[model samples]
Target: MDFVPLWAVVIDYILGVVMWTLIGRFGMGLFLPENTSFFFMRFFVQATDPLIRLFRPITPGFLDARFVPLFVAWFFYMARFYLMPWLLGYSVMGMLSFPLEGEIARGLANILYKFQN
Candidate 1:
């Protein structure tokens, strides 16, 4: 149940990282070349386009092209690392019971609590 959503998020993040690495290192045309079949690029375009499109507006043109993928990757990582635990803790006894969620929450809590103490 919850694992599905968690895995989806993880997979999305991994895809984002891979796409970003490939494009940043090899250039966009490598994935979306004009001379080849359209089908090959479909998955690459779909997975990377949504995030790039969403961020393009707010980001300056100079920075937008280079930073969009990195920003999206960081955003996904933060969502998994910070928001998930906070939301789960806020909902359930200030403690997460699920193993994965619980581990993340405890690790983050320990880090924050250490700074406080």
Candidate 2:
């Protein structure tokens, strides 16, 4: 019997998307300057700008501006790793506690497996 609630799954999935997007912005920032006209970089910047702003108070002032996305992503990661299970009445974190990332990794692994065969 599954004990996890549907609402928890949905919230986790949404937070997962935000966390991944923040990390993506950090990765892409390595290759593109903030003011560059590249479409993907622009999209990432626009999408995560609000989140960055929201987390600004907690963000460390010593971090290079380029690293803020990664810092914000870490906050999300911690929330999912610790807070999610606590909210769901679990005493410990499960392997699949992060549903969206687990599903994505499984899908990618399956695709790689098929390609290898």
Which has the greatest TM-score?
A: 2
Q: Rate the local accuracy (lDDT) of all candidates.
A: 0.54, 0.88
Give the alpha carbon lDDT tens digit for every residue of 1-117 in model 1. 354356544654564465454354225544455344665455555566666677667656665344556665555555545565565455544232334444567899999999999
Give the clashing residue pairs of candidate 2, or none. none
Q: What is the model-wide C-alpha lDDT for candidate 1?
A: 0.54
| Candidate with the greatest lDDT versus the true structure | 2
lDDT of 1 at 25: 27
* Residue pairs clashing, model 1: none
* TM-score versus the correct structure, for each prediction: 0.42, 0.87
